[model samples]
Target: MKEKEILINWMEEGMTSIPNVLLKNYRRLQLNETEMMVLLHIYSFSQKGISFPSFEDLSGLMTISSSDCAACVKKMIQKQVITIEQGEQTGYEFYSLTPLWNKIAALFESDARGESLQQAMTEEKDLYSLFEEEFGRPLSAIECETLALWIDQDQHDPAVIKAALREAVLSMKLNFRYIDRILFEWKKQGIKTVEQAREQGRKFRKPANTEQVSRSENAVPFYNWLEQ
Candidate 1:
């Protein structure tokens, strides 16, 4: 019964709640173990209705000296993890963790954006590999630059670019200039999808006059995309 009473007394002493996000990401926020402990002590004091705990009060709860505690608090303020705000009483101040929470929110947003960018990069790399496989050699720097221009500057869809590459291969052109001409012609015709490109190919296969039929018989099986 005496031990049970002691446990009840400990429970009644109250608890301090720390944010799980801060505990998980404190190191990433550039805070060392000692600095983290100092922040925890301040949080505990705030929970108990003490807005600002002195260096002596912090030091009593920590293993560090009072001077060291003061230094840690100063560094945290400089890092913008905490701020000293004016209190209700003149000449009095309190530590606020608003800046620290803002930093954590920014970090979360950056991580989410980073993930999206990484996935895009992975898809672009796969597209490059497909080009290398078709050409049977790694692309030259100029060739890679041309491909990037098609995607970034020309705003061509990757699927459409792949369809243009297939057309170039079928015509036995198998060169960057010929593939670029195909893409230019498709863009001028407002072709935006693989299906649209295939429809254009079907139209090219049908000869309107005897002159076009004679030319087709003289050349390879594929349509000459450059002539169009």
Candidate 2:
């Protein structure tokens, strides 16, 4: 038989689809906004022939402080969410989401051994397939385990969650902490069924169902009316 082939769909504008496989790692690693931002920055920079950027560049681009950036980088490195390589810059480090990237790619070809991406990623398989293929290797151990655990817990793909995140970001520009909290809350509430999500929306709208009341003018004082 010929070797298995993998195909991923083209990225859509404003698509927030991150591989669902990373959710567990996301929580375990305690990946905050700055850290996640840095990883994504490195991922994007890699495309432009810049695989590793110093902490300075990362902080600068993400509009954060040097100390803050360094702290986040240290955390990512400690968690194995990213790898740091020394370079010309002080405290230089390189970061990548290699493990997450691979799991996303494997979404197309289900492995019978462990947690299956087949279920969570089926709806948005194309969205992540090629991305995984692009970042084939060089994954760290922590990321791999994190990916697997997250994949195990996820009944939904990152694609849908991303769309919701993007909408929330655009509307409220909430930080990653808020996004994670929201996802956690939604999952805890058993929002698996579409009908359940819809019903929740309906329930949420109940408070807004308040009837509009025209402003009532204050009654004029009796003495004031007499004076007039």
What TM-score would each prediction reach against the true structure?
A: 0.65, 0.32
Candidate 2 segments exceeding 4 Å error:
1-25, 85-96, 99-228
TM-score of 2: 0.32
lDDT against true structure, model 2 = 0.51
Residue-by-residue lDDT tens digits, candidate 2, 1-228? 323322223332223444455544454446776677767776667665577777687778878887877887777768666665565766655455565455445543555433454555563454244223333543356544433433356644455345334433433433334434545556777666545544553444233322321232332111111111
Cα RMSD of all models vs. native, in order, equals 5.6, 27.1
Provide the overall lDDT of each model, using Cα atoms, as 2-decimal numbers.
0.90, 0.51
* Residue pairs clashing, model 2: 9-126
Clashes of each: 0, 1
Q: List the residue pairs that clash in candidate 1.
A: none
Best by TM-score: 1
Clashes of 2: 1
